[model samples]
Target: MEELFKEYEDKIPAILLEELKSSIDKKTTKTQLKKMLEALYEEYLESMVEPGESVGIISAESIGEPSTQMTLNTFHFAGVAEMNVTMGLPRIIEILDARKNIKTPMMEVYLKEPYNKGKDIRKVAELIKETKMSDIIQEVSINILEATITVKLDRQKMKDLEVRDSSVKRAVEKQLKSGQVKIEGDEVLIKVKSKDDSLNDLYKLKEKMKSIYLKGVKGITQVLPVKRKDEFVIITAGSNLKDTFKLEFVDTERTTSNDIMEVYENLGIEAARAAIINEVYRVIESQGLNVDIRHIMLIADTMTASGSVKGITRYGVVSDKSSVLARASFETPIKHLINASLVGETDPLNSVIENVMLNQPIPVGTGLPGLITKVKK
Candidate 1:
């Protein structure tokens, strides 16, 4: 078996050979294994793309056609979680357009050690959420004539956050710079120093105090600790990958955000490219579509070919085209043509769209080959 494996090691890909070696039965004869190896090699050869194939156009069509079947609805997870994730066509569009601000930014955060085993998972989740002043406070009373604001903090909530009254007083003082913050038991009183008896100033101060930044990662609007298989994971609505990674208990290796630009900012272009493929394919698979992974990979490759993610839009990938006619053909033809003509740009007719515009064969498939001859002098 070792001799036979060594013989086919050079003929077939290492990955495929390893998979075959692991899955193949030890009881099988050498002849059977050799036959199986030959069959896999033959199958692999048949799956390869031919030279000069217009793979870009094919991949575009392959992805574009199945995308039409995807519904434009967002997936609202059932039960107590109540999280809304943008799926189907809208998500696909968001990804391909490379929109920085997506409709629903989310993250699946994995934890380390005992935290992943549902131990203090709720506490872990609470710590991951963005805690505002309103979250820990029970009520706010505005004194009209006195020009003062009274805030009642929830004792249990404050205890859960492990915040001291003195700390709360300082935070309140820092937040509202114009007022004097006084702590009375569980309540915080804000006295307006301007001596204005108007109701407007007090109400504005009350509203401003409600949103004072508290502990926890900012922009994490909600967190749900869901038990997946044997481990508990956090699914957050608003994504803050940079801040999320800073937590001591977070397993950064498996944790990921759905935002492409965020991933690109934290990781490099290669990670961004992989993210594009995963995100697009995730949406496709969720919609029950059967597009090939190679198609998605090709699109991802093109999007990140320039060391940065560029959308398949007129202002992005289309704008970077070398051929003047190719750029003009995408969208806003008059604008592109006018801009090219003003710059005295020339079309080499080396690509598809220009040759098609001139009623000539496209430089693909059979038309890709050309003959070079030397004349006898």
Candidate 2:
């Protein structure tokens, strides 16, 4: 196997070779291995584009055609409404647009070792879901006469969550920087820290204190523990990739967020690229569309090739195009033209759009090759 691999290492792709080696057994003969290598190499060659092929347009059309048949509804419950995911055309558009704030930001948190086997499923789920001060509080009252806010904490809920009152006090004190928090029996008393504070400020503080981050992962509104195949997984409604990774039980390698920007920030551009491809493919697959994966990969490559995830819009990938005409053709022709003119830019007519604008042969396919002849001297 080693010798066979060495014989075709330069000819075949490393990824293809690796897959072939892993699938084949010791009983496989050398001749069979050589034949397999040749077949893969041939297929690879056939899969490659022709010189100066207009691949970008083809990929666009391929993706665009199937996208029209996609479902209009954005959310797909997949039998669990709590885990409702954005799907179909809206999701594809959301990803391709590279919108910073997606419709539904979610994360799939995989656990490590014992926890993954459903040892502490509910406990793990509770630990991930964001617990606001209001959620764990039984009642909140504002005293007009004394100008104090009284919060009665639900001891049962706190006990079930294994959250101590001291921890709650600390969390409240941390958030309510200008207020004095005191524990009176089972109720938490909040008094103005400054004598100059007004009733409006007190009301504002009361509203703000309700949202204080008391426990669990912040931004995670809901968490559902699911037994996927055998391993238990936690699906969240909100994405906080950075904080989620800090948890000791989380499997950072397998745990991933659906927000592409979040992935890019927490992980890197490569991971973001993979996320984009996976996310787009997932939407298409869910919609029962048959668009080619290569088209999706091509778009992903374009989006991440610049070392950042750029949208397909004018402000993103289009703005960075080398050809002024290509940029103009995408969107805001007047603006692009004005900017190019202001900069005294020149179009070399190397790409498709520029040549088409000049009414010349678009430099792709047969037009890519130019004639060079020597005349009689």
Candidate 3:
């Protein structure tokens, strides 16, 4: 391997020198010429793959003294056909190094280009074979286990406690009557019963019990509750906000816009958005769909901008013309309107552009778009 590498390395510099001479226009100063050639060579070197520190491959041993040589005669057309000249080992080394990085290790390289173009691919394969590196690289897949806990109280305890105290029993009965407790097999499932599902109480409970329960399970990764019509969701084990959102639903008639905003206010906008995005990405990825996280970032930003939890395709906060896309496309109506009103036409577009470029939305509507549109004559 060292001998092979050395052969290629020796051939690279001469190729580079020749290519540089032919490519540059009328450069007479030796110092200037050498500098330019050196820079190009350095660039070519930099483009080669750097073995990651964790890869455990000693660089000095792997990249032995390069020695390789090849000559080519080609024609160039700049008006009339002219003699095209080329030369050196350095350029070849550069190409070989680049090809090594470009080709997936231990994989057959299939090249598609003009004229016997698969030559590079074949060359890369030959290099891999010659270097005896076919078995050195391995592919790894990682699996992460994310677990959450859902707590269920003993129904007997709940009922007994209610029966023991008349006033507390009355309150508990009221909650049960209101469908707060779902009884399943002697277990009292206690979920949040308020329209405003604030997790402060749950947080308090978790804080109080966390140390005691820490030994039983892993620390609470995320605390999320499900929300239902006119009822708050129970905070269970998972921290996935998006899943929590799906578990939460509001009856359009029973829940008011104020109620939704209040819920968002209780959970910080960033946290809420992160949860929603995590859930969205989870669903998307599970289906073997590929989407950049930045798209989710945009969705999160839009959701948080209005302080209302809405889906990506929803036409409320995200669909507004004064949001991120509008600013990016130079069509922010709200900013333009504000600037036009305050600074008039004399204001520079640059200033308005700069001002609206901040990743925030201008307040309009309920911040949350209404589902039902009211018609007017």
How many residue pairs collide in each prediction? 0, 0, 25
Q: How many clashes in candidate 2?
A: 0
Report the CA-based lDDT of candidate 1 relative to the real structure: 0.89
RMSD of 2: 2.9
Kindly indicate the candidate among 2 and 3 with the higher lDDT.
2
Summarize candidate 2's per-residue lDDT along 1-377 as a digit string, tens digits.
68879988898789988999899998999889888888999999998887889889899899989888877887655675366778888888889989999988999999999899998799989999888888878999987667789999888998888888898889888888866889987899988766566778878988999999877898999888888998999999999999999999999999999999999988999999999999999989877888889899999999998998999899888888898999999888999899999999998778888888889998788888999999999
Residue 201 Cα positional deviation in candidate 2, in Å, after optimal superposition: 1.6
* Whole-structure CA lDDT of model 3: 0.35
Per-residue lDDT tens digits for candidate 3, residues 1-377, read: 22332444553566765565576665456566656655666787886545333111232222222221122222233643122221233322222222212111111111222212332332222221211111111221111121111233333543422222233324334533432433344223334445343445544433332222101112212222223443332222212222222212212222211122223544556655665455445534543445556555555565567655553332444244433324334444575556556754443332223334554332332322326877997
| lDDT for 355 (candidate 1) | 95
Per-model TM against the reference: 0.88, 0.90, 0.23
Model 1 per-residue lDDT tens digits across residues 151-230: 89999988897677877787788887976889888888888887754677677777889998877889999999998899
List RMSD in Å for every model shown: 3.0, 2.9, 29.3
Q: Give lDDT: candidate 3, residue 361.
A: 37
Superposed Cα deviation of residue 68, candidate 1 (Å): 1.3
